[model samples]
Target: MEEEITFTVPIRPDMELEVTRVASSVAEAMRLGKDKIDEIKLALIEACLNAFEHSKSKEKKVHIKIKMTDDRLEIIVRDYGVGFDPSKVKEPKIEEKLKSPRKRGWGLKIMRSLMDSVVINSHKGGTKIIMTKRR
Candidate 1:
């Protein structure tokens, strides 16, 4: 059997916590391991924060969808904002980050590292991130 939950949140402060609460409940219900649930929560936070800080969405909202099966979980995070080119983003290097004043830009890398799979779809209108993990 497959189960799904969908929700939308405004691009406001602390909204990511609300999303994480829902995610935690769903993951617990699915009996996901603690480490896996933590990873999911962290990745979801990064995705939501990116939308909140960078999406520049006129609607100022983020959309999330989670699909769960017997042995798999899939999450989608989306924002209707000015999209960015992933290819154009430079890979963050530790040395450069240490030297640079801005200590950010690790969201994509972190999400990919934590999730079993991550696919990004971004155009001029919006960006969508699809991430999955297997039990």
Candidate 2:
């Protein structure tokens, strides 16, 4: 059977940590390794930070849904805010990033690197990021 947990958090400083704590608990219960758990937490942090910083939602909140099974875990982070075109986001080069003063646009890349799969659906209404990790 699948287990699901859902909650909403206001966009504020350190709110991402609350979400990460829950993720850690669920991942631990799922028997994910320490390294995998750390990766999930980091990916989740990036997702939450992105929503907090960029969503521009009137609600000023982020919604999270976690689905877990014996062999897989899926985390969905959503925000009801103005969305942007993912295609337009430029991929940052490490070399340029090191030289640049502003070094903030790596959330998507980090999430993708840590999770098994990352899917983003964004339109004018909002954005939803579905990240999965397989055991």
Candidate 3:
């Protein structure tokens, strides 16, 4: 059986921690390992932050949906803001990032590295980031 929960909140900085905490609790309830739970928390925060920083949605909100099963967890982060091509975004160089620290581009890379699967769909209308992890 699969269970799902959905929530939407304005793109505010304070909401980031709240969303992360709730998602972490859901992962815990599904009996995912501790390390996996940590990864989920980080990914969720990054996704939300990206929406707030990049998405110029008129509503200024992000929608988060989490689906849980016995063996896996899937999360979708959606934004109504103007979307840009994910392919156009270049991967950050580790060496360059080390020399000068800036905070805008690392979220996607970190999420991909931590999750089992990361799929990004973006068009002029909106962007949806789908991430999944398995036990």
Ranked by lDDT from best down, the candidates are 2, 1, 3
Clashing pairs in 3: 57-81
lDDT of 2: 0.95
lDDT of 3 by residue, 1-135 (tens): 899999998887779888888889898898888999999989888888888989999999999999998889999999988998888888988787778767358888999999999999998888999999996
Candidate 3: where is the Cα deviation over 4 Å?
99-103
Kindly give the stretch of ten consecutive residues in candidate 2 with the minimal lDDT sum.
83-92
Give lDDT tens digits, candidate 2, residues 1-135.
Answer: 799999999999999999999999999999999999999999999999999999998999999999998789999999999987888888989899899998879999999999999999999999999999998
lDDT of 3 at 22: 82
Error of 1 at 21 (Å): 0.8
- TM-score rank, highest first? 2, 1, 3
> Clash pairs of candidate 2?
none
Best candidate, lDDT: 2
lDDT of 3: 0.89
Tens-place lDDT per residue, model 1, 43-124, is 9999899889988999999999999999888999999999999899889888999999988899999999999998999998
Model 1 RMSD, rounded to 1 decimal? 0.8
